[model samples]
Target chain A: MQSLTALLGLLNLIFFKPYNAIKMNHLNKISILFFLLLNLFFTACEKDNPTPGEDFGTFDLIFDNRVGDQAVSLVNADATEFPYTNNMGQSFNLTLLGYYISKIELAGPNGEYFADEISTGADAAQVKGFYHVLESDPNSQNIRLDRIPAGKYDQVTFTLGIDAETVQEGATGGVLDPAEGAWLWNWDAGYIAFGIEGRSPASPREADQFNPENGVQIHIGGWKDIAGNANMVNNVKRITLDFPSAVNIESRLSPNAHLEMDLLKVLDGHANNVDFSTTYAVHAPAKGKVFADNLAAAFSVDHVHQ
Target chain B: MHFSNLYSFSNSLFGIGLLALLLSSCTREKGIAPVAVAYEFAAPAEFPDPIYTFKNNPITKEGFLLGKRLFFDPILSADHTISCASCHIQSLAFADVPLHGVSVGVNGLSGTRNAPALANLAFKPEFFWDGGVTHLDFAPLNAIESEFEMGSCIEDVIEKLNAHPQYPSLFRQAFTTEKVTTPYLLYALAQFMNRMISDQSPYDQYLAGTAKLSEPEIRGMDLFQQHCASCHDGILFTDYSYRNNGLDSLAIDPGRARISAFAGDHGKFQVPSLRNVGVTAPYMHDARFRTLEAVLDHYSEGVVASPTLDMSLQRGDQLGIQLTDSEKAAIIAFLHTLTDRDFLNDPLFRRE
Candidate 1:
């Protein structure tokens, strides 16, 4: 949708005719015709379909982030309840844990592929093409994708972080809204696709660093074309999960895909053996790539409740 | 196959081209023009893509004029005694005069850091001495709220503008909004400042092959390239990187370190562009050097060693650029070539 400011400007230009009145007059007529055609087209299409779910079933994309068995909960200024320790032997407290999940494409057993269309809120308030799996918000974690072709699906492939387009252009509303204050890293000029800001006792500066009193923030994002000779890298990552067993989807019904995202893997599961003492804050792109790669490896399809 | 058929085909092709051009031009003409003066933001052929995204806040003639008016008005401050122009004068290339080591604000309140020159800001990735503010739109917020500076709240400024008889109408003409918003206000400011580009220096003319440099100036250019071009690189004259140039062994202020929260970043500051270095006297973040000669002397003999000092400035046991008196004079002559008089005198940017 065009911004209100742009629409007002266009209206002002139309009312206060410039030197090129003939051109403006022609533009006005063209714009009217265009809107008329657009209105008619949508109305006709909606009339023909009537109900979108007649041929297909709705599916839920459930993201459960955890540290081993325990569910991840972001605490506000109280970091003493530290329950997790990595291979580096550092007692870390996670104050914030959230990442963007997008571009989900599900493949059928017989080679039928369906791309999950991202829709926000309820059907009435739905906006398409953008999805964010915010860990703190239960509503955001339970993503409802509508109109998946009714059939058995074997594989599900999706990006772990925000798409390159959203990373660069930035979004105005929904999960990507600047006001949401979760994803964007204004200093780096890109979206923090995978963010985990907290503190740990293993930091060289402070022993009780994770104790809310001394918090260290780690914001990971660098979606550039190339990692310049500088210390950062392109940290945006894509992850794919294939189901162990095929799940059947009946027509006009709802199904849920139970997915698990392990937080312990962010440090120990990947090739980069990160030491909390030296690598606690990974804001730069190159340093952030280690966490990004590990987070991509953390997702797995636990089960599919058909 | 026939001559008549070929003639009709060519005529049709020409007609299509004309129609495409007209349609494109029509789309370009939106609202009242943002500026009365016909200035367009075009990066020099040699420069990199500007950090400011024109897509978000497109420059317009009306927007530029409104920003210009707002910039000069003292209503932005708590007391009606100072504006941006009070510290940044046009004659001094938008930098404070020699009297102020650091610029004085409303009620003769003094600031910590010297007011830097305001030119070629669109090309800069970050703003201020420490590279604290990343976006050009948000840079003014720091100055406006600073206790020693304007000391006025943004919400108060907005309320004042809304009450002003002429400003609300001017804002409506520029950005066709029902009421003024902070983002729109920032967009207007960005439009005005982004066009404050200084690309017409004698050095720039030399690069464009439009003017010739004198013998001493030519020699000075070579010397500058060898010694100074690493940090102050490219046509806009800055790499926009933060570095500790070894100004003081113990920094009076921990510069970039305060923003980044890294011990290694201590004493580091954003490399200031030398575009109008001749007019923007009292060099460096502290404004300790009054003249360009003093600045050159500092580099030659007065650099203090520090833990986070830039490796480029370090030479064996000593710190700072080594230069003879004649070489220093020649380098100063070359620095003078960077003065863009046309930009400094541009009436469009003036308070009037």
Candidate 2:
């Protein structure tokens, strides 16, 4: 009964205006403390609420080739140990495995390709030299886009090779320029499209650990038939990012997040075949398509953090 | 006394007003009106569509002025003595004056191949006699940086441009980028060259039915249709495909093979477009011929027998296509029709 009466009295004091409530001894001090507590509660709520362009609200569509986490990879679709080799004695371990990802589009929920792709690479000075070298050391690459507009992009679409229209017609700056080496042909007029390299003990080429004699130089590029190559011009490559929850393009994605990609699947293909003498070479349209499809899947949304 | 003073004051005010109006009228007449320059480039109506339609880069008064400044500015050269016009002279359809088989640049230094004239460049798919540089915008780099030609690096050229007081703003106005890089500069150069489209020749007028080919010219056209049209396809004139036209089966220079590194591509050279073939003479990569008759003689029976000689050239190449004196005259007449007297003297391409 005393507690009930005390609660009623406290409620009455709260309902009353401060001047009236602060009537008893020490009443003024108690009112001041109550107001301070109310202010802190509202401030905390405002701080927690996030909006577009806020620090927490962000989306970085990352691309990666998982391939056994760049450590030990599977060969011939078999659960082989790390650093495994495929049938034609093809092995793994890459240093700078990178190439130009010219055009990219993120798929919307309703399956529309939205193209807002752009490039940020080596400075004008660096691009002018080294026509044959690709720069993919550690974590410097990944079409890291400018803070994109805030919205949930359901699916992502991207092209594998350079757009012929952009290349043939001409672009004065960016990756397409010959001086950059991203798109280069020393003795002719074509471009080196895709590149993937690693430490392959399986390759007879890199056997000389001391002197470096034989190592498989698997370089695949040229103007392939656009009609079939999925990485070709005008092809809309849609990869769905079926998030369990909502995603925000402008907010809610984190940085320093790793999107592990699996390149073994890209090469091995879905047929469960990895004969790789001529078959594993992947020089045909079907191989290009397989590479593109598997590469798209490898870009599944990873954990987001600082 | 008051009335007289007021009258004098009124008269003075009127005098001041008249002087102000007269001053304003004089200033208006002398003021510069921003040079309202007019310009346009057109392809022949009857001809096939142009390959280079000035899409992103158009021919504007400012753009043309920028091109003209760069063309004349020796700042483009390494030593700053030779401009592009040094080799590509205006009077000769913008082709090098055939001093020898190849062109001589800075200090009379000789390069590998002859510099072809800049005519109907907009229609050309491949550039150079051997069809090397893929994009037209990037061609200036080869010339600017070639050790034999201008002998300047692109970065060096950019540095020179950046130092200039007026060029930065001028380049910015032409291309939106503040920093004038090689590609933008090359693009501007190409715009200038590509716009050098010359289709207003008498032959064009004849095709339009506005004029008629002369009797000799008609006969020349017939012969050209019979012999030349197979290789020199249409408006821009050449098929633009690389072929071994019996220049040499095993050329020391290794024409197209230098790029392709292919076995079969030993002496293959891009078919030369014969648009302004008359004035832009001393033809072929080597510029071996001194006259049109010499060129005709080569086609008539001088083509060498080689493993890679064009099958069409089996009959002596030039030896078989040999023209009799009258036949030569007829063929020469047809070649003359291709001369665009109007383009040679086009005021737009002329120096301001």
Candidate 3:
């Protein structure tokens, strides 16, 4: 009985120690916090598609815009050789390089705006600024979209140049932000529906100098209304394409030279009929219409992504 | 006999231990001081939600400070002379001042394009007037790498930052890493530009019921709504779409068409936002019109018909809408209301 009393007393002392109780409480709190931290670490978005870095996948767009060679303008032919015999007796150099294509739309063979939930794509918005194609694209810096939904499409429609609404939105949208050297309508003022600048001294202004001033910047736009006119049907031109069948359009589509703009011929009818009385002048209305219409009609189905 | 003495010592020990633990936790309870996050936008309710969502990069005091440092750092340039602020001045509402219409670059070389104001940029979908850059984070590379601008590559900017002692720590604190990158560099600059929301103008006040529009202003608004609103829609004053407004429908630049490489895309360009048109004179793509009167004349008697001309313009009866002289004055008065004076005087945007 004496031994039993001793054991019971020892047990009471061990169980009732305040230091042990405090230690146990501290340990429990630590474990809970550890678990919470572990959960957070695991749940954090730590996955990288490849390298965890600042860049997402890039959209490398290679405009086979070279296919534009099919279009032959009298002043600027679709091919490389000069296509003009002006009053100066010298053939104007014809470099068939094109301009900015702000937006694009696709239409089915039936003349309907291509729309489908299965295969989707955001409006292919360009990263604003002037871009050029070298003799060869090194990193395959062709046209790369953020990503489009996978599906079969009948046709693709797109805008060859800037649209009217975008013209007034300023540097926020469209292809005319000062950052993007695409719109240089500073010649007479206002926005240039089409801008063509190159080295040609035979024309007005110095050829070879990259001058925001004093250079020949042939901006051929302003399609909404001619300042004082109504229903001008400005630069909004339409081109329809019909696909052979449901074509897989999971990749970027570039219709080479099939989409052509002869930079030289843009002003073929301008110098003679341009009215420079005011601070702002423009190409003859009828001639501007013909150029825009013919250019719009040039874009058709080059091929289908099957 | 010693029980009282033992109790006194043990009680004292427990009391001191408890106080220490409690005090340590209380010291940390202030929670990082919730650093001040003042946007100082002075924005208006009428404007659309800002495009700078602060996604991935949250708006913190450290972030703003880091961005401000980058803005003034010459390290962004090739030779390290020009920062973004060199061309984009504060007094001119972030626009390049002087008569050249172009911004000066490294070696005093001037750029080919006009230096537009970076005001109200958070509302824009694209950056330049041509609408080439869709995302704000990447816009700097263009000017930085432009032969005439800063003339540096994105990789070069990163290299320069590594050499600076203050910048490394600043970047680490703001981005949570010791590493610097293009997106980080751009993200910081974009944050500064995005926060440049200059909407507090007389027009904003009139729209918000705090002020009233004058009769001329009201008349101008009506005329603008009928004639100009089709293209310059919404409070931002632009529909954010590309157009060929019949400026010169030649085959020249083919504005937006070059990006797409399609024929129908020819002769198209982006419309500009008209928020501070009065202060940002030399209007249009080329800074052509010296005054609002010139632009009004272009609309009243300057329109030339082309196939691509917007159909809405055709509805004005005659070839174009012939505005009376009174109507022109009213429109100009309304456009003047868009100027935001407070933005021009903000000290935060100024070089400290």
Candidate 4:
């Protein structure tokens, strides 16, 4: 009975003495719970109001894929009627068309710069700011950038594909995830920054699964610059476009920049007038360098809506 | 009366402890910090810093186990008939059996290149005969999607994994995600492969001063340093450079040229590590030589001429290395010391 008293005393000294010194009572318990609740409330409030007294708004980037003046209408691979014609008078119809956009930056006339948060990791939540714009998926074409400080933005810059640094970060999820329809070259081990697959009469009849008879697949991908290997190419292009007019981003107003990517410009650029017959099957980086060179001129900021 | 008072005091103390536990559990639900069971990954002292980006995917016990299951499971294959383990058996130092010169995949389709032994992969900057794959995470995609291998795309594999009863929960436990993604899948596999460090070989033990080599083995080691050390240098025994090694007269497979797209790289293949070379017979990228004797014989007298052939193999008009029968036997005896039995028989890598 004496030993039990000693044990109780020890327990009281170890666990309860600190609380006792603080005057533990019903009121203290109530106050502690209140403080925890206050912490939870403040954390919740912090997220909504990241920067107090600062005006912020959402900015939308609308990618409008077009074949010259007409909007891109994705045709079936087996479709016989070709809707688009190149400068070389070769008729072609696209079955699939897409490109990865990352490292977005917006510049204002007043020197206000906003660079989108870029991160790559195994977790889907950690992988951010990578937009895979596909012709088939209309929803993917619209990218909404939140928490933009209110400013009159005049220009926007973005990378056409996943950069070499991001590729070296190893496997990434979200839009960069290959399982979710990401164009990845497994053998070469890099993301295809831009890709176009379609049927053209000028293309030779190569009766393979990926390349059906008269099938044209132009995949621009390669993000490694090995030292002393001049033959190796980096096709990732940085595209900068000037907005037609300065658009105000305020809490009440969510401005949108509609950018048009013209397919005809890509095929008929001054650098290399793509002859679809011979240049139909472009799967390597060197093979697609000519097409990737035209990507900068292919994109143009058509309009901005405030 | 005093004892009763003490009991009540002790009861109140217990109540306070319960309250604290409840509050801590609430904080955990808020996701302040995730509790991960860490698995230690330490490189051998002689090895260089690992090339794998471990910061992106830290090694956890759960993640390693998930990866091990994936490695052994045939579900990654199209018809569910072939697994990574089907070609890469653990007993043979993760190399295919001798009969399988080139690994047979789904629907009994044979691969073109010989299945290389997987050991000390974390140290390698590149993978495969052509050295096309730059990252370990991206390596499996080739095997999974290749027509001559697993014959399944990453999309279908993810779909299949999501449909599995246990895989989704296992992945969730490993990666802390609601859905299994490609990165997590690759991370798990990489985690498993990275742990396959072969540092317990007799040669390694000799270097560590725990064991000693025989007279012939010592002589062979000296000869190896004199002849082979220029290419197969350091602890891993590979310089990781692309070389033709006089495999053929003409570039038939277009090996490294397929990746580099250069005529200079034609017929060139990455120098494979000689670790576990004793067990990984059916040698070279094409699996041309079935025995170590034949491999040495090729090095001695059978090196064919090629435009992109390694300069080391040619000494003016001489095409190959000069080695007698005794020297070849001694070299083979030394090569046997590289086999790490502990790594080959580790039950941790076995299917549970």
Q: In order, what lDDT does every prediction score?
A: 0.72, 0.58, 0.54, 0.86
On the 0 to 100 scale, the lDDT of residue B190 in model 1 is 78
Model 4, position B114: C-alpha lDDT score: 93
Q: What tens-digit string does per-residue lDDT give for candidate 2 at B178-257?
A: 77765567667766776676777788888888999889899888888898888888776788766676666477666765
Question: How high is the TM-score of chain A in model 2?
Answer: 0.54
Ranking by TM-score: 4, 2, 1, 3
lDDT of 4 by residue, A1-306 (tens): 334444544654554455653578776667656655654555455544333238788899999999987889998877999988888889889999999999999999988788899999877789889999999999999999987888889999999998878988899988888998778899999999999999999998587766778988899998776643455778999999999999998788979999999999988888877887788888988788888899999999999998
Question: Which runs in model 2 stand beyond 4 Å of their true positions?
Answer: A1-98, A106-114, A118-140, A145-157, A174-250, A255-306, B1-38, B106-109, B209-212, B257-264, B315-322
On the 0 to 100 scale, the lDDT of residue A276 in model 4 is: 76
For candidate 4, the docking band is medium
Query: How big is the RMSD of model 4?
Result: 17.5
Candidate 3 lDDT, A239-285, residue by residue in tens: 44554554443333422212223332333333432221211213322
How many steric overlaps are in each model, in order? 10, 33, 127, 0
For model 4, the superposed segments whose C-alpha errors exceed 4 Å read A1-53, A206-208, A226-230, B1-38
The digit string of per-residue lDDT tens for model 1 on A1-306 reads: 224334544665565455464656777767656755654555455533433234576678798988777888877655566677777776777777877777788877787567976543211124365666776678988878666776778788887666545443322334554433436544444467777767677765443533344455566676654222132356777777888777665564677799998888877764865677777656665566667777767888888887
Candidates sorted by DockQ, descending order?
Answer: 4, 2, 1, 3
Q: Which one wins by lDDT: 1 or 4?
A: 4
Which ten contiguous residues of candidate 1 chain B have the minimum total lDDT? Answer: B1-10
Each prediction's fraction of true contacts recovered: 0.03, 0.20, 0.00, 0.89
TM-score to native of every candidate shown: 0.63, 0.63, 0.49, 0.84
Which model scores highest in TM-score?
A: 4
The candidate, 3 or 4, that scores higher on lDDT is 4
Clashing pairs in 4: none
